[model samples]
Target: MASERIDLLIIGAGPAGMSAAVEARRHGLEVLVLDEQPSPGGQIYRNIRESDPQRLAILGDDYSAGRRLADEFIASGARYVPGAAVWQVGEQCQVHYLLEGRSVVVQARRLLIATGAFERPMPIPGWTLPGVMSAGAGQILLKSAALLPAGPVVLAGCGPLLYLLAVQYLKAGIQLSALVDTAEHRDILQAWRHIPKALLGWRDLLKGLSLLAKLRLAKLPHYRGARALRIEGAECAEAFCFSSGGKVHRLPTNLVLLHQGVVPNTQISWSLRMRHQWSDAQLCWRADRDQWGETSLAGVFIAGDGGAIGGALAAREQGRLVALAVASQLQRLDGARRDHLAREPQGALARCLAARPLIDALYRPQAENRIPHNEVIVCRCEEVTAGQVRADVRFGCLGPSQAKTFNRCGMGPCQGRLCGLSVTEVIAEQRQVSPSVVGYYRVRPPLKPITLAQLASQSNHDLSPETP
Candidate 1:
């Protein structure tokens, strides 16, 4: 019922949002941050302050880095609203959200979205089975609850996260049946061209290599050049099968963990109707933005994986840059002052992203791997199959939006978050055009679901004398 206004409103309190708040507070900006999680740290560094000592050591320094940022943000005196689910972000900077089943509205002079990223679509037969989950989902379980999958877990897919999860499993003394890596020999061969540049991030490369080395030394089963992966079971995932090194192999397992990579969580950005472009390397749509994370909208900005797939280091640096830009725009900081403050963080962001091209090339998923087979489910929310999507395409649906009209591929509760990319790829393949031309869904708010009762309550509250 009460509408609060602030100089700056940031959605998400992850690395980018926290860092931005800290820097912006230094400039004396009245800043507020809204985060959906019960605590700070987002996904990458979830539960840092409360993590068990033994678990912290097992998770390693990459995660530990978040503790400093979180602590600084907490002490920075910025107002933070945790466990608030943002529903609508209007173009004019009107923010509508739900907190504890109560509707809250806030208007701000400027807004920043740092919602971060989610696991890429990795659809295959029987993926909707109960025992099958994304690697990120499994990682969340570990990070939030200190939980690990039961033995004979089959991790099928390839990416840095896959290896990271494997290392965590090892550290937790969890057993794995095998790692079915889809990175083929040709991808590594192609990645060699970028090795010189990749060396700039030698620390990351070494860390990655060390994880693999540990996996090898552990004598854990690993399969390379894996393809045609699918899960099988009547009710839940009972086994996994894939082709590796020209041989078809199947493993009896109850848990099938999958990871391809991550793409920016673009739901809010898309709902805001920001300009977006498809990235060939990461195989996703990225919101168009300037170096300071300003989107096409006048006073709206995006930082972190919400804008693109840069990791935490880039996100933190970018957040600082955005804070400076926002301050400058508000005339709190002069243009020259903004430029001077931005210099170091800009360089840091560049260095952090130097090896991204090589890493992206090395793990770029295969084209077939992206577009699901006809029988495979594309939209889990609607239970829409790839075949259904292709059929819609053949019936003159040229893009995800058009396909959604004929088939409810993106109309479910997820609002196309999980199925948007797959739907685009399928439409493009069927239309014999590029995915870029096929375009993505026209995302609208509410970004997350809310009850009609809440809407009615908001309306009634707005008309009441208590509202200001």
Candidate 2:
């Protein structure tokens, strides 16, 4: 079959994608949105439509705000296809996705990638253990299934999300064992310079402070400046061990939720061979995108956390900005009209992102956590340890792609999503060079796994001769 064609195609239904879809529809653009989730809200607002009143109360207003965006998106008349896993994107704006066990293709004049961020890997010892998972996963369980850990849970690591989840769990009456904060005092000190500007986004700063206040009210054990984290267990995670304030502490817990912060999900961008730069502030690779979210590649755009580590509000504004840019590019709106339309969202985006410097500085992952111990498992899919990566680097393996040949690190089922940052940092540390110099994995196409049958089923007309 000939590929379904549209004026604009958006991947992901998060705040960015949803907002972009709504704005594009207003400009009389034929927009189609494809998402991997079963629901409209991305991870931030997952299941917002189906969430009960009590659950909404527990999750708080920031999450509930997504409902308005979702409703707007639905009412905007954009075609939305959920549960569509886009595996490959071509340079010509052709997208191949798997839906209901069939591979389908679509081509668009313009494409928007709003697939948001993922938590940075905290590759401490025994991180791959059964009972240890990211704090984001725990939030997902609570959001989607209304499930919490059965026994004592220890939320370890540093970030605003760590305390936010703790407060949410407290509201749900799930008592946490302790919070092992990996952030150092120096982090706050480093962030002090950004405080004046961060105040422009005072509501966020207040929300963070409020979350901490609630945790204090509950009298939860908050271990500050924690370091040298290790999960101890023979089979599953039994205890979390860490050092703080010149003393070692071991907390017996069945569940350990780890998080430092989130980084842009640049898998698709990298796979497309788009230019990327290592962000020293956020400590991750960010795709090079213009003010309106268009990337190094023409006709393709990135919005939300997929382009950078902006929060939900910033992402929503970014989506609107990209929509304006796309509308202008398609001549649906003149450049002057588009600029006039974009003014509000541009201001909003600035306001939303004003506090990021403070947040990034305050929660920067320590070198020890970023560059794990030699024995720690960095690549969980291939069971590649940091020691192996370092040994390979010492043997003259230059970068992540070279390390991939030395050992099957990024050649895993997840395609370096889980291990890319860790490997880059490890090689950079070993070589005494910057992460930008060491570089990230050379991401190729077939971004996600697809069956041979799925490929065979696609019509000849849908296949592209040119590789992305």
Candidate 1 wrong stretches, greater than 4 Å? 1-5, 459-468
Query: Ten residues in a row with the worst lDDT in model 1?
Result: 459-468
**Model 1 TM:** 0.96
Candidate 2 segments exceeding 4 Å error: 1-5, 459-468
Candidate 2 C-alpha lDDT tens digits along 213-330: 8988999999999988999999999999999999999999879999999999998999899999999999999999989899999999999999999899999999999999999999
For candidate 1, the lDDT comes to 0.87
Q: lDDT of each model, Cα atoms only?
A: 0.87, 0.91
lDDT of 2 at 204: 84
Per-candidate TM-score against the hidden true structure: 0.96, 0.97
- Candidate 2 global lDDT: 0.91
